[model samples]
Target: MTSNSPKVLVFAGSAREGSLNKQLAQLAAKRIEALGGQATFIDLKDYPCPLFDQDIEAQGMPDNVLKLRAILAEHQAVFIASPEYNGFITPLLKNTLDWLSRPYEDTPGLGLFAGKWAALVAASPGGLGGIRAMPLAQQLLANLSLTVLPQPLSLPGAGSAFDEAGALKDDATGQKLDALCQRLVDSLAKTHG
Candidate 1:
């Protein structure tokens, strides 16, 4: 498509198959692509990092961590859908971000995240709709110097929210996600287009 669309990276905190967070992240990716933007959908499963350990880092960063960092740095915006675990971000997501926050050679500190735009979305089977996870994730991204979008998507009772085809069954909820995606794209263009 001959469109002025920014590159966006979309990912979920969970690595398990059939995770609601993954489904939501995919939906966000589609929305971005539908707007003529390039969306790179990444799975944390592909980039496994041991729990953050200073000793491990003192030796050297993992290949997967370096690969993930390079991939993230290519994008202008990020869309994240994190599953809530005991009212917090999943450990996998936290560790990945921790690695990304570290300095890399030839890049400024927080190179993967600095000046990037981010939007958060979450899906949970519980009543809170994964809203609780957004704050910590938002704070982390903000600390990395990303301009986080204030509005977020929290899909409660998400177990039954998607259809067999994986699209949100409720049109209204889907619309909210659409808006969030558009805002991310627009915000990125304003800053980095």
Candidate 2:
């Protein structure tokens, strides 16, 4: 990709070994690269931080949180595949976001996220496809000053959505993912141009 190509950080809220959200995130990263953008796919399991606490902040940010913030600061956009937990965002994601939203050193609170773009997707085995958590996730991102895309993808029956090759089994579902990645890439062009 060119230096001008959009750099996107792609990750999933769930870090379980066989998480459907993780599969979705991996697919998104590949699609982003195919569309000529750069995708930095990460696993939250690698950047573990404690639940957000003022006491911890007073001591100093965790090494992992600092590393994660640095990674985020370098990207122009983020693509998240969130898994729902009881009609809400996963606690891991919420805690991570909370930590990242804090001010560190000279950077202001939300500095890592403000004015950046974000796209969200979710996958679940149930019929709703984790749709119940989309609005909450969107609102949280917006509150951090990120401009979230309007059309979020929610993949229901995720257990069977992907083929053996890790590609979506449905043509229509694949097309939707392509469209979302295209929109993100196009938005970067518009903003950067």
Candidate 3:
């Protein structure tokens, strides 16, 4: 059947069963579904890649990188559930971006990221929110030719935002997340259509 909705992919950088960021991503996807938009939450656990090194890249990008770019090419926009690692992005997310950006001068395969709308959402148990990581993530997306959304969704004290089943539990947080999804859809439609 033909789909009328714009497809968006939400990547959850963390794979932990209790990942608060993942929970946030799930909620964002639900919001998109509610708004008549299609959403797919991509769990990082399913994507595998070797550690990134330019020397390693010179040999050839791993097949996983190509697969990831293919996945990105199918989506109109992206929402990322980033977790902070030492006040920056998780190494896995960083590695994924590095691999996707591997096509230089001669090689082809720069789908997914270029001209795509992206939003950064970070969650941590700490009081400061994952604020330090958001800017860096935005910069990374920018470097990849993505248009990072100016307003981001950050769940401070994420420990309190989800239930045991990983569903968003707080009403206010739910509303905020819903709004973020709407913002992403609105931004993508205006930017691409």
Candidate 4:
């Protein structure tokens, strides 16, 4: 990657083993790297934070949350592969965002999110490909001051979407993902370069 290449943080909302969203996130991270951008692929399972609660916050911010916030702050863009749970974002993701939105030390509310860019994608076993969750996720990110990209990808029938190597089996679907990653990288170059 070059000095001006966008540094992107890539992660999925779900932590379940063999999760399709996780596979999608991994692919996105690779695509970003292939496009000459720096990608940091993280697993939420490694940075476990408790469910957001005011009582907990009143005491002190969780170390994991603080670590996550620091990681986010270092990236110019983020690529989120979320799994749709009941037509909305997963509780884990929402809770993590809630904690990240809270102020700590000299940082203001939503300080980590402000002026950052985000690209969202989803994969599901059913038809619609977790598309139902995209708008809600976008709104949540927007509320936190993130400029979400308009072009999002939702891969349906995720159970059979990938090959043994974890790459998408369908060429068309893979192309769509490529386009989304390209848009994200190009946007970063335009804004941060």
| Ranking 1 against 3 by lDDT, winner | 1
Instruction: State the C-alpha lDDT per candidate.
Output: 0.88, 0.94, 0.80, 0.93
Cα lDDT tens digits, model 3, 25-92, are 88788888787678888887777888888887788767777678778778988889999988999998
Question: lDDT rank, highest first?
Answer: 2, 4, 1, 3
Instruction: Estimate TM-scores for all models.
Output: 0.95, 0.98, 0.88, 0.97
Candidate structures ordered by TM-score, highest first? 2, 4, 1, 3
lDDT of each residue in 68-131, candidate 1, tens digit only: 9889978888889989898888999889988988877887668777778889999999899999
- Scored against the true structure, residue 17 in model 2 reaches a CA lDDT of 93
Better of 2 and 3 by TM-score: 2
Name the regions of candidate 4 deviating beyond 4 angstroms.
none
Q: Note the residue pairs that clash in candidate 3.
A: none
Which one wins on TM-score? 2
Error of 2 at 33 (Å): 0.6
Better of 2 and 3 by lDDT: 2
Per-residue lDDT over 13-119 for candidate 2, one digit per residue giving the tens place of the 0 to 100 score: 99799999999999999999999898999999999899899998999899999999999999999999999999999999999999999999899999998779999
Model 1, position 108, has a per-residue lDDT of 66
Report the Cα lDDT for candidate 3: 0.80
**Model 4 scores what on Cα lDDT?**
0.93
* Pairs that collide, model 1: none
| Candidate 4 TM-score, C-alpha based | 0.97
Q: Would you list the clashing residue pairs of candidate 2?
A: none
